[model samples]
Structure formats: structure tokens, C-alpha cells
Target: MAGVDEPECALPLDSRDVRCCCLLRSFSHFIVKNPTMNCSVQTPQIVGKDAKQHTLSPTCTGASVLGIKFSDGVIIAADMLVSYGSLARYLDVERISMVNDNTVMACSGDIADYQLLKRRVEEQTHTDSLLSDGFTLSPRALHSWITRVLYNRRSRMNPLWNTYIVGGLESDGKPFLGYCDLLGVSFSDDCLATGFGMYLALPLLRQRLEDQAGGDPRKLSKENAVQAITDGMRQLYYRDCRAFKTYQMAVVTSSGVEVRSPLQLETNWEIADYVAGYE
Candidate 1:
């Protein structure tokens, strides 16, 4: 009766009271059935939280970077194209850079992030120069430093979203090649590749290296190393969708790091002309 607002009934007091009690019970049941009408009760809210401070994904990414260590030095190669999804967004982008006279770095992933990483390396190099008494960072030392930096960023959940290959000669003029990724995972190898190069180019490199040096990358000659890396790049251009014919190559030796001219690979599409779906 308290919620119904019914007109007064002209009846005995006991009967009227009974009817009022019944009405009140009905009103209580209705409120329970439709809880939304009860403004006093609050509904619980749902929220999602994540530990990661930043989202990690590559945008406008470059493809594989290939590296090989040889008797004299190290050789690295990467294509010049940066792709945004399937679209080749940036052409002539240099993915290979000389960190110092003794080291070269090649990277695959977001070009913007790679540029930022390059700036950081340059800053570190400058700082080292200021502090050094005629002592510079060697290839091994630089690679170790970069590995620590990448690992720290990964631990913070803010990664560079790139895979890097550091190749050069150690202080003792020994060939050095190391690989690092966004997660700070790193290892040294006679041959290394990132992205599709790992799938398409790695086998070729391994086979060639084996033929030339019995799988001993350190035993490979400079000419054979260059040939292997160049052939791998050509194969990548032919097979990888994100790759292109134009690329940059770098060789690091006891003398210095040399980045050769941007070169183009010769591609043959003659097979496509005879395919079943030929136009």
C-alpha cells in the first residue's frame, strides 16, 4: 500500500488492513523483479588493466637484415624499402649504418624506431669520445652495450620493435657478428638474418658458408662472404614481398667500416609469364 497509492476502501478496518498488506507485498515483489527502478543501489563497474606501459608493434617496418662473419671481417646487407602493411611506403631508406670505424649495424622493423636507435648510438659514441683517452668502443663492446640497452627497454615493456645485426671486427681484428631483437634476445653466430631473411636467405647463406668453409663462418674468405651476402639479398628481393631490388651493403674490416653504394638486384619474372594464371 505504501507504493501502490490506491484509493481508500470503505470496509471494516481489519479487512482494509489485510488488503493494504497484500498490496504492499505485491509492490515489494515488483521492485525485486525490476531492480533498475531502485536508484539507491549501485551497479558494479568493470575495468581492465595491463602491466605493459606501452603497446609494442612495428609500423612502417623494414624486412630482414642479413649478416655474415668471414676470415677478414664481417658483411651485412639489407633492402632499402620500408613497408607500411603491404604498401612500400619509404624507398631508399638506409637500414644499415656505421656505428663507428669498427662497427656496423643493420636493422629490420619500424624505420622511425631504427632512426631513434641510431641517434642514441651516435650520442653514446660522442659521449665515449669525450671520455676516452684515445680508446674507442670496439665491435664487441658496442654490441654488448646495445644488447644491454635493448634488454633494459624490453624489461620496461617499452621496446624499440626492431631486430638488429651488429657486424664488424673485434679489437683484435677478429670477425664479429651478433644479433639482437626487441625482447633483448641476443646471440653470436657466423651467419644471422632477421625477418623473412631468416627463412629465405639463411639456408642459402648456411649452404654457401658450408661449401666454402665447412660451416666455419670464420674461415670464409672476404670475397666468398660478399658473394654469399649479395646472393642472399638478391634471393630476398625475388622471394620476399616486403623486400625490393635496391639495397645497401656494408663491410667491416680491420681498416674501417665501408658502406657500399645502394645497388639493385637483377630480377627475372619470366617464369610468371608461363604460369597457369597468365594474363
Candidate 2:
């Protein structure tokens, strides 16, 4: 057996294949095939763990969004502030935006997530517009769509951290106000508030409606609705640490939607001298 010569292999095309075919195909059989020749061994590459794929923590976030329904239609307000943790990182950021000619939506949470949601909505709207049938997403339809999307993301455990308030005229020309949150929880309300506004501003509007409009949102005049939202935003600036004096509001009605540019709310620290906060 020691005197027996190895059988010939298929001729290799290059010098790289000089090590016999058996050894070239498998490093384990290299030394056995050719005792005098040497083969270079390569270590298998080890890939490291991948970085976190989804948004595990939100960096830029907005605060409360306040909405109210009046006899004319629905009005929603949000301060123009995007905070990085406790620091006010962005000023004059518009949290409330018009989704269509007749619909408006606002969010209180991670601005980036909301922006992504906005693009999705816009793409859907564009696709619908391509139909050219004069049909578009009504306030109710958009609200439902946003709810489903948020819920779907939540189910996947990578939620788009946003609490939304959508308002406008329904397909039937009736005023509609709907809310959706990060977990996809949603409901329609005559008056709605998210984030800090839920605790500080909601009660005020509810009380005002009860006292002036007999608890019926339709009884309130358009002026009253605007006044109520204004007051709520004002209160938020006074109380919500994340709230800014600068804000924006959108009014949706049978005619169309009007989103006011960023404006400063009139605030007063007059009572500051008389009151002291907890140490």
C-alpha cells in the first residue's frame, strides 16, 4: 500500500487547484491526499448579533392634543413642541396636520412615528385620488384606518408610539371626532384629549359643554367650539411641562378644513406670585 501511487484527478484549470481535487474540495482530506503539500485553512466567519430592529425608545415626542365638536364641526389643537425626553428639542413643530381637504388629524407622541404614519396616509390618499371618482377618505374612514394600523403594529410588539385625534366632517356631512392611541384603543367622542390634556384639559371642556350646551356637542356654536379649544390649549401651556406657548389648531367643517399656522397662546403668570408649587 505504501508503494501504490494515487490515481489521477480531473485536470485543474489553474495553479490554485494544484492541491489535488480531493484536498481542494475538502480541507479535512487535504493532508491525507498529499502528504508533502500544505493547504491554507480559513476560519469560519462569526457574525455578531444584530442591532435592535425597531424603535425600542422614542427620542422626540410631542405632548397633548385637544379636540372638541361644536355645532359647525370639529376643532382640534396641539402645541408646536417636540421634546427630547424632558428637554424641549424642537420648537414650532406642527403636531396637527390636515389629512385631506375636509379632514384634520393630530397626535401626541413620538413625532417620527407620526410622520411615518402621515406618509402612509398620504400614499393611500394619493392612490385613492388616482381613481378619479371624486371619492376620498372621510374623517370616520381615516380614523378607522389609523386605528387598524396602530393596532396591527401593537400586536407585533413594535408599536408606533402615538395617541391620535382625528376630526372632520363625515361622508354624510356630519361632524366626526375620533381618537386612537399607541395600543390601538380608539373611540369617538364629542370632546377628546390625549397626553397631559386628558388629565388637565378634558374636564374643563366637558364642564363647559355641560353648563353651556346642555351636554350636547351640537348645541355649541362654532365660536364656542373655537373658544373651548383655545381655552384648553391655554390651560395646557399653563400646566403641561411639555407644552409650549406656541401651538396650532385645525378647524374642520362642512365646507372644508382650515389649519391655522403656528401661533402663540396668550399666557399669564400673574398668579405665580400668590401661589407656590411643592418643593
Candidate 3:
């Protein structure tokens, strides 16, 4: 748990209260101060008990989002482009998650907040109530829960630093694709993308997605799905400055979740091969 200062301890609790380090201490006091008070607190999902609210703006972060569909699995690709202020920095970031035996949670945001959300979602199923009630959370539901958390942070005037694209199986065990941004905005379907991907990759994907109901890549074989997602990455690299050929790819299917980091593209880069040059 994080610590709280005296000034924060004296403020009235409300929906707009941004959680600070001292807030935890105040929270601890709340429990002690009112043993019979009924309350529920929402914490970042994956981050452990010590996550803090660092005040930062949401935009100007160079994040990536891509969606791929094939005839056994679906692939979601995100560049490891972590930006420092306006300058694009860090290329070894992997935005995809292998959270469980069969799910992958991916994100584009404040790296710390992303990790926190991942941890919380993983811990949910381990609790006795969810297991005993025979009720399990689907990828869509988890996506929704994450959106609410982001909104809550925004309400407090302190928001998580990034957007997210969550991919996994649906309640019926079918492949699912969904996206949610820092504002808690969410949309699920056969294909979806956020950030630069919404412009670069979505146009190519919608052709296949609108073709049928089972257009998600998860319905296809892993190899085909991987190829589709890789092709999309290639386009994003050529167009999006924050993206490159090298990326992290993950496939979620009935078999399991597979993630390959630092995946690169082999391309012919002869400058004048296809164009007339000054010879």
C-alpha cells in the first residue's frame, strides 16, 4: 500500500479524487475509522498494491495498435515504441500479454498503469468467489472493467498514461478482439485497431471483417493469422513514424496464447531497384 500525507488525509472523499501516495494511508485509516462502513475501492488491475498516480497528460504518447484476422486464430500486434515526451523512444517494448492459459491482454499507455491492470485481472480468477460462483470473466468483460478504471482515474483528474487493445477468447470460447482507450472507450468485434493502426491497418482489415461473422484471425490457423498480422505491421512501419518492422506478435486460439517478441521483417530495400535514379 502507498502512503498518504496529512493534507490529503483531510480532504473529503469523492469520485473526483485523484489517488495519491498519501491516499492509501488515509484509506487504511478509513477501514479503522469506520469498521461498519461499507465501501469498495477500485485499484489498477495488474499493478501490485503499491501503484501510484503520477500526474501526466494522456496525449503525445507514441503508442501502437493493430488487428489481424485469418480463417483459425486472430493476431494483435503492437510496436514496442515507448515515447519520452514528444520524442519517440524505446523500441524493445512488448505491449501484448500472456495473462493466463488462454488469454492475452495488450496495451498502449503509461507502462506502469498497463502492468498494474494486467496483474489485477490475473488475480481476479484466483479469488474464491469467482471460482465458486461458476462465473468467469470474458475478455470483453475484462476490457469493460479496464475502461471503467481509466474513466475513474480521469474523473479524479489523474488518468492512466496509455490506451489498450485486449485480445482473447469470448464467453463462448471463440476468438475475440476489442479496444479501449485511456478514457474508458471500448469497442469489440471481428477486427479493431487503435492509435496509428486505426488509420494504417484498419482499412485493410475491414475488407475481410465485413465479409463474414467469423472473420477474426482466431478462426484460422496460427500460421496464416501470424502472416496476416505481420503484413499489417509491415504497412504500419512504412507509414507510421512511431512504428517499425520489428514488433511483438501474439496469437490467441483454442490451443493457447503464443507471444513472439522482437519479430522482424525481411524486405528488399534496394533504393533504385524499382525507381529510375540519376545515373
What would the TM-scores of all predictions be? 0.81, 0.80, 0.66
On lDDT, the stronger of 2 and 3 is: 2
**Stretches > 4 Å off in candidate 3:** 1-62, 69-71, 86-88, 125-136, 208-223, 271-279
Error of 1 at 123 (Å): 0.5
Number of the top-ranking candidate, with lDDT as the measure: 2
Evaluation by TM-score, superior candidate among 1 and 3: 1
Tens digits of per-residue lDDT, candidate 1, 1-279, equal 244344487654565776877877888889899988844866675654663357456678999999998888889999899998899988988899888898889899988888888998899889988987777777777778878988998898788888999888877778889999988899999999999899999999999999999998768899999889989998998788898989999988888888986888877888865668644
* lDDT score, candidate 2, position 67: 94
Candidate 3 structure quality by residue, lDDT tens digits, 110-191: 7777777777876875673456876656666777788899889878877787778777776566766777777767787666
Winning model by TM-score: 1
The runs of at least 3 residues in candidate 2 whose Cα sits more than 4 Å from the true structure, single-residue gaps closed, are 1-53
Candidate 2 lDDT over 145-237, as tens digits, reads 999999999999899999999999977778999999999999998899999899999999999898889999889988887888889999999
Worst 10 residues of 1 by lDDT: 1-10
